[model samples]
Target: MRYLCLIIAISLSSSAVFATEDMDAKLDNYRSAVGKLMKVLKPELVNAMKSKGPVAAIEVCNTKSPTMTNAVSQETGFVIQRTSLKPRNVSNTPDEWETKVLNQFEDRKAKGESPKKLEFYEIIENDGKRQIRYMKAIPTSKPCTICHGEMIPPPVQAKLKELYPADKAIGFKVGDLRGAFSIIDTITQ
Candidate 1:
């Protein structure tokens, strides 16, 4: 009886350790994928803003962002995208899970957590398949204000209206949580 109980306890403890390690590995991979997406997109945006201004930068986001995200997804094997409460692109609007997560992120930010450090991940079962979902918050910065701030330049506003007629992604200040990079992947057990 003592040996049986010891074996059972050992098994349970080892399973717990394995689970923690697995979660940590997944988190690292998700972080790397998000980092790659940002690294690829930020330069294009900066150059567009510097050379062609905020209107052109908006165009880059409208056109290049999706292509870049898809390429990253293909490379990383993670289905990745961006989402927000107030989305500039209609398609970038949060889904049900994303909405809940984003609201939690907002709460965290309100409680004085740094938006740059905001992130969340979890394992969820959907339709009988297990998956890991991760989100990393994007904070509004000084340059972001050129396109996303309260007082947009007329040209930038015109271009934004042309692209997103019902745009609601504005009135942001530096340090605000703009949105997040979200990644989801099936967990192969």
Candidate 2:
């Protein structure tokens, strides 16, 4: 009986330790991936605004990067079918996470607070397994304002409309939530 108790206690304690370590590693991966993407995106956005204009820069972001989309898939089970300045219809795949994050961002703006590190969890099923995923929103910077700001320049606005007819991704300021770091089952390995 003493040996059985000792063995059980050790097993439970070890499992708990492993769980903690797993969570830590997952978060580290999430941060590393997001950090790498931002490092690349920030400079490009700044340069685009300085040389090309806000619209041009945003265009680059729209087509060029899949940091958010890829992250959603890798972290969560869901695939981001589309992320537009405005909402659009897709034959399949709902934009549930993106829409929720965006709405939270707008609410934060209305409350005169910068949305940062906003998080939420979603339960999902993948390959017959149940999983929980997390989503986080981080604000855009000063440079981001030019494209997603309250008052875009006329030319920039025109370009935005042309590019994103149903665009709803505007009316933001520096330090306001531009988007989020969505995490899914892609928790730590």
Candidate 3:
């Protein structure tokens, strides 16, 4: 009887370890997908800013960001998107889970954690479907300030208002959390 109990304990322990490892692997895959998406976005944004200005860069973000995300999602078999606590695009509004995570990220930032390195992942069971969700925070940088800062130039402000009338994505300072890349990968058991 004691040996049977010991066997059961070992089995449970091994199962927990295996579950943790599986979660880690899934998180790694999500990170790689997000990284690829960023690599595509950054160069395009930089070139646009260099050639035209912040207005053009904003256009690149508005038009090309989603296309790049979709292409990466197709390649990785994951749903990828960007969301913010205060979104510029209405379509980028955070869902319930995302909102909760974003709030937690804000709390972490308030506690002096580096937003650039902030990330979260979990495996969730919804309606009998298992899905792995990951989020990586986007910290505001110098270039980002040209469009998303507290003091936007008049022309840039005009362009932003024209593009996003209800934009709440301004007033960000350097090192602030701008938003996050969200990735969800369904796990088929």
Listed in order, each prediction's TM-score against the native is: 0.88, 0.65, 0.87
* Candidate that scores best on TM-score: 1
Tens digits of per-residue lDDT for model 3 on 1-189?
Answer: 999999999999854643767777777788888788778788889899999888778889898898888888898888999999989999999988889899999999999998878999776776777777789998898888888899999999999999899999999999889999998777754
The runs of at least 3 residues in candidate 3 whose Cα sits more than 4 Å from the true structure, single-residue gaps closed, are: 1-18
Report lDDT (Cα) of residue 147, candidate 3.
86
User: On TM-score, who's better, 2 or 3?
Assistant: 3
lDDT of 2 by residue, 1-189 (tens): 999999999999854544656666655655555566667767877887789767678766776555555654565354333333343212212256557766766676687754655555555556655545555566667766677888789988887788767667788777755556555553223
Off by over 4 Å in 2: 1-18, 67-114, 120-127, 186-189
- Best lDDT among the predictions, by candidate number: 1
lDDT of 1: 0.88
Clashing pairs in 2: 26-188, 75-184, 75-186, 76-184, 85-168, 86-167, 86-168, 137-180, 139-176, 139-177
